[model samples]
Target: MVENPLETETLARLYLAQGHPEKALPIFEKLLSREPDRLSIRESLARCRDEVSRAGREAAVNEKKRLRILERMLARLTGSTPPEEEIPAAPAIQPPRPGAVERRLAVLKQMLQRLERSR
Candidate 1:
């Protein structure tokens, strides 16, 4: 029962193409460990790590923006002053994917709905 390196590489690339770099990273790491001299695998591993790092940063930024929006919405509901800083312009957001903004907006809407129901 031998695992084919080419098959493993194909699986890793599939994960990357599907936008699951986190899943792909460990596979690349394992592949690199077994064949450290493969330049192409090394490069792919580096790229996977970069994508994972970028995704984490983007998530953090989006979480902050979501919290800010929620805080303002709550303040308005409670008749308190909203935060002094305005929500940044829409163009300021640099999402990693085309559907990221839509997904965030959907989550925010659900949060707002829950808040309203609690009142």
Candidate 2:
């Protein structure tokens, strides 16, 4: 059985289009090895390598952020302060509507008065 090079190339391009550069990288590598002079193959291989590198850097940043959060939680449990470093800023919180707390308290007071009258 013979493997078609054109089919392999198409499969590699498909993987690249689907954002699976890691999967496409080795396929492009193999294709380049078979035909080293093909400029398209060389360009695809380089693109795959760049995508893989960018992914690695992003993963590292995310891992660091996760570790920092874990460390902060551990510090709170142990009654110690975490060292000040590059902590990612928390998401912005929206303030409650005007008079929201007063309205809730008024409702609770009305309920209490009704209960008292019934007793």
Candidate 3:
């Protein structure tokens, strides 16, 4: 089957982000054949290789967690099995965290922006 370059690139990057650079590289190479001038794609492919070399799984792990959150959120809202892998290692975080300084700062920034817009 023929694969679209855009889709292949996207999936390759996604796979690399999910700690599967082995899976991603081939797709990226194939994508390169189709879009040899895309520097970002090549850069991501290189980054994927770099990620494999480093002793880090946090980015991929976080990605898994986020994918799970979306899946669970969808499942709760619409009674259907999500098409993504669900990582259930951590608790879900809300945007409006009760006591976080950063959250408060973000709200204040939004308010300040609104106030500025009105002036």
Q: What is the TM-score of each candidate against the true structure?
A: 0.66, 0.65, 0.39
Give model 3's TM-score versus the native structure.
Answer: 0.39
Pull out the clashing pairs in model 3.
none
Better of 1 and 3 by TM-score: 1
lDDT digits (tens) for residues 35-117 of candidate 3: 89999988987887776666357667788778878878989789887676635588777676567888788999999999999
Query: Model 1 has how many clashing residue pairs?
Result: 0
Worst 10 residues of 3 by lDDT: 51-60
Report the number of the highest-TM-score candidate. 1
Tens-digit lDDT track for model 1 on 35-62? 9999999999999999999999999999
- Residue-wise C-alpha lDDT for candidate 2, range 19-118, written one tens digit per residue: 9999899889888988999999999999999999999999999998899889999999999998678756999998888999899999999999999999
lDDT of each: 0.91, 0.91, 0.78
